[model samples]
Target chain A: MTDPAVEAAIARVHREEWARVVAALTRRFGDLDIAEEAAAEAFAVAVERWPRDGLPPNPGGWLSTTATRRAIDRIRRESQRMAKHQAALMLHDSTRPDPSGPVEDDRLRLVFTCCHPALSMEARVALTLRLIGGLTVAEIARAFLVQETTMAQRITRAKTKIRAAHIPYRVPSGQDIHERLAGVLAVVYLIFNEGYLASQGKDLLRVDLTEEAIRLGRLLLVLVPEDGEVAGLLALMLLTDARRSARVSATGELVTLQEQDRGAWDRGLIVEGQELVRERVRAVAAGAGPPGRYQLLAAINAVHTVAPSSSDTDWSQVLTLYDRLAALDPSPIVRLNRAVAVAELDGPAVALAQVDRLADGLDAYHALHATRADLLRRLGRSAESRTAYDRAIALAANPAERAYLTRRRDQLRG
Target chain B: MARYLLSVFGPTDPPASGGSSSRSELLQEWADTGAFNDKLQREGHFVFADGLEPASTATTVDGRGERPVFTDGPYLETKEHLGGFWVIEAADLDEALALAAEGSRACRGAVEVRPFNTPESIQALLDS
Candidate 1:
């Protein structure tokens, strides 16, 4: 018999409180494996007992306490085999002298751990998804775009490194904070990138990853409230998320902004995003520092969202923001986006000139070809446009992109 | 809350062959360490502790299901094999870090601290 009560409790444990509990227990139990085992034991107990006895008022707290006790017991049992086990007992004894107060913030500690610089970028993403995102190895593997076995090994190796190096579990301070903060942002950005454009799969977007990234951004904002850049990043994500609904048609076809139904855009998200951006800008202007890449991106997005129609978009403002963004973070991708704004504000010829100046490395890039084709077609260069469209079609990876490119080719021929 | 895993690694180089007296002294020190572990168990903070054999004895298995390929090597090809580990719970990273120091002293080797994944994180990924 499938017990609804037990199932519901498990769902609650997994959804609403598991990370908090695990973090709290992990704070007490220094070892990841032991902490995991103890937390599992607590969950097992909850499965067996929660149904019989009503769920505790604070299930998370109960789980944390239970897991802590189990960890202590496990430590005691293992003490017999090694010389250092005695010291382990001593440390355990000293720490548990008082358990009356509420459990400290384990989630914050977890974030710092996930963002540990000792781990590689891949390891950091994998570990963050594993520990902070609470994903299974198989799920992480899928998100990682790799084999499950490979991901599992990566995770295990990462854990071994943690065990071997004895990486501390706390938020860094002073100068160390800046370096660690970058690691933290990188993981958050990685999650957002995956959501913004899934590298594989049929879909262009993964809303779940996007939403999760936003959630983590929100959490980061809470943890580091004074950081205008963090606020800026949140605003940027919100603005991007606001456009998700209009990004595609009901049939899952890609819908460019000019063609999208402006009415379908989420007004609430746009408003929230605008306020966040405005607040961050004001804060930065007041003396926090210069606006960051995220702030600039948000400013550009705000221009788009504030406009009543596609034609009403403040191209000048977008161009200005793009210029600032490019200056702040010079990248080929940023230049590509800037070219679009230049095309609108100036002319196809100017945009084409700008594109030509870009490095030859982008010759194989689909977006480069796509943009060239669009510009060429607008200039009435049909044969050149068709050739560019063909190149785009060849370089395009996603089905929607291929279809879009093919459609452009047909239009050029017509 | 903070969590850390403290581990002590055995030296890569084996103890040099020596006369009986030096060997006896090393064995005595090893025995003292064993009793120290028993004291740790009674205190109730130990998660798991195991002494691994030399790196040469390690066998790694890769792949999954039907054909898990077995290879004769440690998971990490490095000389630093995991000799033993203990998971300790602490109130914060500082506290967990302090325990790591103590762990090193007890085992006569280095100790590492790390946090575990929480279930919330697992669901967060699922939600993503």
Candidate 2:
């Protein structure tokens, strides 16, 4: 039987040091598969040995050394069996630390590698969750609603491609850093969105995915603290997630922002998110680089959190931020979101005009029709509002959203 | 270390009269090409490098059927053709790309770098 103390210590190491240990091993071995496998074997050994030998003061170091030894043994065995000179050379390299350690954080290099643009977007997410997030293939598969076999195959294919293509296991430098950072941020936000508004499920939210994304966001901040966008992304997720409890009614019906009880919002998250936004904005004002899209979005969320109630929301400020966002990224979704702020600040007529302009582009987007429905209802065009609601209900995939739209449509008919 | 094939592609037609080059310009181009080849050789990265004849003189062979077959010209009908190539050794893709950039500057044409797949790399993929 495993000792309870050892179990707890192993769990803690799995949670905190998995990525670090895997990263250090990966750098040393120059192979992700070996690194991850060795790390797992080391953890397995720890579960058995830590119970008997007592926990080491430097658990990460112990784990790294153990994993390295396992990797060396495997490499040597493989080389001897296959007579592969390259494998033997790699084994020799792995046994010695480089005189010059990595200049940048190894975890950051691992993150960049996991999110490399060479891989498909889905592969990038899976790889990041598996490698950096320390999620098992089964867990990632479950989160993505795919078979365990499919996720495993995807991860293996990605790793194989990384090896075959010789994708550098290093953080990109100069202009490439900004471009690559976008990819990393995009993966994190995509994970957060999957959690915030699940694409398909009976439940409206996946708290575990959300927490995981926030954890990654925090990790990125530590890895690249100078990046204002990273801080902004973490803040955006925090402020957006602060209303998790208030986002749904008791019966699991979707609660619109205006209907949610502001008192139910997590004040701690709001305070923390607001502080981050303020710091980023202050830094920008002091001649730091201008706020990126995520930073601007966080600023918008900060505006919403500062309001005591929905009606008291600073609409003009929100509208201005939306305009800025629309300028930065003129996607139909951004314009659709901007229309809502327009409705609040500039009345239904103006907002309806903006929404109508987006009709052709956002025809398939459920939120576009929903926003139109709300604007029409506000303008007392009950029949038009009902029609818009019908479109929205048909397009919406989430049960909560569909039910909410159905209720609204029924009220209009009445 | 890995071996990369740096394939250079260029248009079949020479420069037009409006883009005429002077004698000095031709000499400078030759000088640059020589310097690039020398650098690769000096660095012990050069395995083989050579320019190719135009595609018009090339022949195509297809043997998917029972008997062999032959075609008149290059396989693909494209404006640009493979003009030359260099096989060089490099530590990794980054070095390969950097070397390709120098080759591109030397040749004044697009250079594509592709790593050679050896048995060891294939084995590594399977092991991974």
Candidate 3:
């Protein structure tokens, strides 16, 4: 096989089969370290032989079989009493016909365990990408702009913690499920936000993180179909990502939502997200529980995306959604966003007063300053606007955002 | 399963509740805490739990060198002295944290949980 073709085939198989292979190995071997190492070794073996031998008839099956063999080989290499027991189990399970099920419960267990609150947020993200998302340590490190060794250590330490602490390897039930499901959803959402807006980097977006997060969201939707928040989170990510192209200009300047080209926005994502929101609303009307945080967020984004242009956006409806969101999450950031809608409805003066009131809570937050600068500019207070813009530019981490703020500040009356 | 130290941090010198009703409330808190300890023992999670005297009564002695140095307060002279602690076995950190939450409520003080070092845990870290 040609090199590029073989490489592409391997990449595709790795993405499709990595999680399945890892989950299966973890279940059989009952050791994450063994599972992770064996899975990687199996993939390495594929990389070496695939080009020479061509793609397997069943890539996932081949990988799973190969990983099992590798795990057994590893266990046999060590003389630990525990390793021998695990090796016997793996040997026993490898011969049986694998059962087919509607849901991959092993992966579901892996997801909950990876996102367990006992792990640090950073560790959770790293582990999820590695174990469940099939991202290599190098790939994850590059995406997060960290060293490969550092990412490797983080993942290794997390796996050690899971084993040592005996973090249960199963989907939680009852009240534990509800609370822990929130953690899983939160990890996914955090991944999306990190991708949607690079906190401190040259790039405005990391497409890989966003794509991985969306894939996880979809997986959650399938694994736990009854959870409305899972669907809501997926919808929210889709709607937010739909605006990616319009979020940055050709010259790499960050574009505000009002200034973004509506035609450039992804209509397919918008339609899909809006449809999901409509479905949730219908479900709620049919006596389901009230919409969750993600659901309400998706609804707000739906309203924005549905508009033909910025001027056509229904500010009142946006404000209403914000009101509901505030009741659910009484965070300063939500109030700041709601104030943006208030500016459109009650004028810039009203919004400016509200923004000032949030200073104590959000003084160090660059977006707050950016919003203040904009409202002040709208109110024809150029001096105060310039001062606010200066603070915003100073505090902002993204180069693109600083560029945009600088341009806006320079445009004001000097 | 692993052992965790759930250390409760209370006021160094507890101020007396102003009224007689408040004093009764304190007694009620103690009774509740006693029940909680009983529940822990029943569940087989209890190892040892006890309250300590106020920080003012602490006496520390340092004999690291040949000439020993005596200190008046805690070993390190810190503000975060443990008011009480419970050493319990749990499946994982989640179980430990959950128990700590209950312990905090029962004692009406903040609780911190730390896993004890085990041979497996140390080996796992070294392997990593």
Q: What are the per-residue Cα lDDT tens digits for candidate 3 across B6-61? A: 99987677767889998988998899899989988999899999999888788888
DockQ of each: 0.06, 0.33, 0.48
Q: Write candidate 3's Cα lDDT for A344-370 as tens digits.
A: 999999999999999999999999999
Counted clashes in each candidate structure: 33, 0, 0
Decide which is better by TM-score, 1 or 2: 2
Q: Rank the candidates by DockQ, best first.
A: 3, 2, 1
Clash pairs (backbone) in predicted model 2: none
Model 3 chain A worst lDDT window (10 residues): A95-104
The 10-residue segment with the lowest total lDDT in model 2 chain A? A80-89
- The candidates, ranked best first by lDDT, are 3, 2, 1
Worst 10 residues of 1 chain A by lDDT: A80-89
Q: What lDDT is reached at residue A309 by model 1?
A: 85
Highest lDDT scorer: 3
Model 1 CAPRI quality: incorrect
Taking the tens digit of each residue's C-alpha lDDT, what string does model 2 give over A252-328?
Answer: 78999888899999999999999999999889989997788999899999999899998999999998898888888
Off by over 4 Å in 2: A1-9, A48-54, A81-103, B1-66, B69-114, B123-128
TM-score against truth, every candidate: 0.71, 0.82, 0.91
Model 3 ranges off by over 4 Å: A81-104, B11-22, B55-73, B117-119, B122-128
Model 1 residue runs over 4 Å out of place are A1-16, A44-52, A76-104, B1-128
Model 3 lDDT at residue A188: 95
RMSD to native, candidate 1: 12.5
